[model samples]
Target chain A: MNPAVWLIGAGPGDPELLTMKAVKALGLADVVLVDDLVDPRILDYCPDARIVRVGKRGGCRSTPQDFIQRLMLRYARQGLRVARLKGGDPCIFGRGGEEAQWLSAHGVACEVVNGITAGLAAATAVGIPLTQRGLATGVTLVTAHTQDGGMPDWSALARGGTTLVVYMGVAKLQDMRGQLLAAGMDAATPVAMIENASLPGQRECASTVAAMADDADAFRLRSPAVLVIGQVAACRMYGAPDAPALAETRLRRSA
Target chain B: MNPAVWLIGAGPGDPELLTMKAVKALGLADVVLVDDLVDPRILDYCPDARIVRVGKRGGCRSTPQDFIQRLMLRYARQGLRVARLKGGDPCIFGRGGEEAQWLSAHGVACEVVNGITAGLAAATAVGIPLTQRGLATGVTLVTAHTQDGGMPDWSALARGGTTLVVYMGVAKLQDMRGQLLAAGMDAATPVAMIENASLPGQRECASTVAAMADDADAFRLRSPAVLVIGQVAACRMYGAPDAPALAETRLRRSA
Candidate 1:
């Protein structure tokens, strides 16, 4: 609250998902630098704070990272409490580490408040237990889009026996599918493409490792969507017609 | 507010870390079934609700999962709002999926409100970004303890080029170290064992994959601790006297 930068995750889309700590930080904020992906409703908590939208959409002409950092620094130097609101958990591909390190080096104190990450929220919204027993031993969250525009180690991921959740992967379905298949991943492994995760407009398209690209094309999957690639994607616990209970699904699969 | 079961995550032992949705659910609860790992302070929000302590710690005399499910069903059947508070996010190794499925199968409506998982919170508490550019492409959250008492696919996890966050791993440090070593993970890969993540008394012991067991022994790492294993674990952005800025660290590593 004392003229420092608070790097807060606004959680995935839904305002209700915001943590009490994040809300408290927003309340103390004198100037807020928020990302485009963050819900504006969350700003209601910081009604008195000066709001600055630092939109940095992937593949879009948006605010540069350096400029955003300088803005936060300027506000902090002016003895104003600055809140940098990001979508999802700030440390999870949100450039929180970079910003925190930069702020520290520039002599601005920074505190990171964790939020519900998009990948986890998207999976749960669709009733996919990422680390369900008998299906996945663990869950791996990776971004397909990188600064170098390269790909993750698909072969190792395919072999990991963990549910793979890919961020910024909707556009690269074909390439990912090809790589996973080539890495000997089962074609029948389930895949779930979730759009606008945790938002009211959230949509899910279920497919398989072999058919996701085509299924996504048919489903009109968009950017900002998350892809859940694993057997658990087929295990829906929510209201889906004919969708077996997770326990039953695991029992059947194991049997 | 409806007469249904709400599986809420208590968010890594911090009461303030609770989501607004989880808080709302707790407010409307007529009965709250709480886990042992959940901090007692969170019950402050549901002071009016009947609190049922269902301790289910591993290797301890605890409540049975079946009995817990039945308790939730009983409360819901009586037209009472039931809140089942689990530590961390319900779906992330907290059995939220299994519980939701059980409630749904019993014709009881259930909802899951996501909370900040312990692994992510633990990483951030120590300024270890789970996924920093050039250091880790993504992160894997896995539990070393399982219902079947079997091990995860360590060889594949070792091959996967993502940071590894292990829950319930304090007890199996040596076994995991051996498997990861056999699987070809670098012995010097940095490891940070975080205890009581996100809490005021949170403690972190930094060591290498080869030396974690000994370090944890020296640090007396306890149960309910999370282990972060990766190159990024060696990278601290806050308060370390010689910790380099994340950008510089990444540049140096890539160079």
Candidate 2:
């Protein structure tokens, strides 16, 4: 028999952001595997379910990926409705892909309920538009969770006029800044770091890439902060469109 | 008095994907400016509110950016609870930033509620993970709407080992394919087109970068289809993480 598993995104620490579908899924789940970042309050949505804390925090004592998959498979075989509740969109950084593939291989049907990604939430909380007219043609969501991988080639990323949202890159602002600057990214490019977005203790700091490390350090920004790099970072600072007031503003971007 | 205005993302095309916050916001709205592509059924969440269709379709008769902003400002100044209901995440490519800034400049308070982006929904619909272990480091959400602007620098976009999700690129696949190839991108890069994603009429097609244009034409994929290009597109064909059974399956990413 196919395993009953649903991978649901918990949506960036905000319980209200949970989709009606995610809430319904949680209500129906017989067993839930919660991520470390997922708020414990979310478990209240699935009160009847047996909850397991699978803290997959980066570089921390966490559950092994293989073992987690095994548990899901075993519970699924027993006819329990297994819900893998992850923080943020399950597909985008949550390792939902691997679990889905494993479930599929074992003939378990998996349904993914998309949720608000942290990058989007972070941008919203800080009033930074990830994409705006005449500036960002797109938004690239990348992570500093490279693990064993080398730093990504930032040259192309720097040139595209797209908003670059670096997740988990708080520890290496200098390296990130150096790569973008070396790739001809303007030193004046505005940068904003939003930490603990949407939470009560959310903090925001803004500066140029050249001085981002200092600003981050000065602001005491920590991990889970989204680093926004692009022209859109200064959208609010610049006045109305066609208004020449912000022309002399130092945050002006040069492509 | 700052009119209560909300920027709500309706999610891809599925009404159920709407977040609880967005639903509540919609119900509280006195006037809602709906985008061209937004499903009409979404308005049921706000049956008492007045709905206005603001067409922002690329390369078509759409609403002017300035006019829309002005209307929003006017209604907001009149103290109407205005809700700008956009199809996907308002901040990502929906021009929500510009509108929000315009409203803020005019002293209108705007609250943004993040929603599920189409690219994530599209990938989920087909069982293709946008980011998975050992293959994709990130996902890039871009668009073919370069109206009045020159085509984006494809060279930089082609370098990163990130999944490229092109929104509204169905009509310009040839031009997009050419740029990626000229930028020295791999010829065999996988591509998947998901049209009408999350709707009953959804259709999916898959091919390689070299043959994507032809495949798109042959498949008759239309506008608004999300085109995914990266190695992970071929992930499902490779089967289990440890199993080598699906190694020989060629480009079976389509649903």
Candidate 3:
């Protein structure tokens, strides 16, 4: 039997970032349960399918986890092709693993289609390589907010020697900056705050880890933004409309 | 003027994993530069365009970076649309940032399109989430080998609360296992070694941080493989043909 449900990552913000595999899944979908963060434009790929908004955005009143799972199960049980669409890669803090396991336990077949994650897209949109050689050995993608309301191990991350990309960090700039400082991260370490990454309305604020909170406040950074922290964060390969202080930062990009 | 050069990611090994943006770029290309690791089937999108093979696989005598850059520059100088396709995200250890910066310095406009990175695809292919809530707060993507011949800070990574995904690690499983063990990572921490991720030939061998090297040896794991190290690495949401030891490991996948 064919897979009844597909958990697809709609990609960051840009609809074009969606994978061809994801588009194929959407085309076959009888109903699509989309997250709030997914661009509405992506739904155009599956215009004939029914669309359901089951947003679970932080600090917002939204659908409960169990209800969403049951809804997908109910739709799949009826032999309908169901698509659970989430922003960014479905498994990256999107509860895709949980949902997939639940469906599989119920004897339903499901497949996950990966997408361009927000952390990676946020850095790339502004010409910052997430793992730029010599500057960073690798990249770490974490979120400032967790389900338990606690924070990630800032001390370990500060010493990890990889570019740190923090999702959902707009509201915790000050707290994050302070924690990183206490963790002994360099005060002059560069940070790039990118909002609405990969979208036409994308905006980037350049600052140092020590000055990030202040710079973000001045730039009026908002939610749905990612913070890139490392030497590579200072690099901008080419000037883009979203970058306001491109001239100053371009000097930092190394070969 | 349109971008003269487009550095596109072909995703893991799946041709369908190519993004719409990458496909659009391919469609507009006058010449296409392909990498060795990239699936040739992706060239279907740019069938009418001139195709140049510029493979740069590790441990192989492949195209030189400088020569590839100059070739792209020469093509772009002629005002041609050049698509440089690499496996996975261009900016992630693909020298995309370096190439883009070089091209931009020479007055050529280049764009880097994000892709579903191989590390993420490998984990998801076997129903494993790189970042499962409670099990892992986040995920770190790093390469086992480095240009400078130095290793990443394993101690800090071991202490960091995230799932670790290591690319180009097939040959160094023994060394990596020792390093992680030396860095205080739990000996029994689950490990999933995935080969040819997201492709039809995908294969998985499940073991632990301590026994990975031995298990991989027994499984005859080859290059183009990725190693997932963490508690979340044990979780397999749904069984697939790639996972030969699914029965034993399924019991360990925590909800």
Give the per-residue Cα lDDT of candidate 1 at A191: 86
Clashes of 2: 1
Full ranking by TM-score? 3, 1, 2
Kindly report which residue stretches of model 3 are placed more than 4 angstroms away from their true locations once superposed.
Answer: A239-255, B239-255
Misplaced by over 4 Å in model 2 are: A1-3, A145-147, A237-255, B1-3, B237-255
- Report iRMS values in order: 1.4, 2.9, 1.5
| lDDT tens digits, residue span A1-255, model 2 | 323888899988878888888998899889999988887878889999999888888788999999999999999989899999998899888888888877888877677788889998987876777878677878898886564677776887888768999988998898998899999988888887877777766777778888888777767778778888998887662233432222222331222
Tens digits of per-residue lDDT for model 3, B68-170:
9999999998988999999999988888999988888888888888888999998888779878888898999999877799788899999998999999998
Rate residue B215 of model 2 by lDDT. 81
TM-score of chain A of each: 0.93, 0.89, 0.92
lDDT of 2 at A57: 84
Q: What total of clashing residue pairs does each candidate reach? A: 0, 1, 0
What is the lDDT ranking, best to worst? 3, 1, 2
> What are the clashing pairs of model 3?
none
| Stretch of 10 with least lDDT, candidate 2 chain A | A246-255
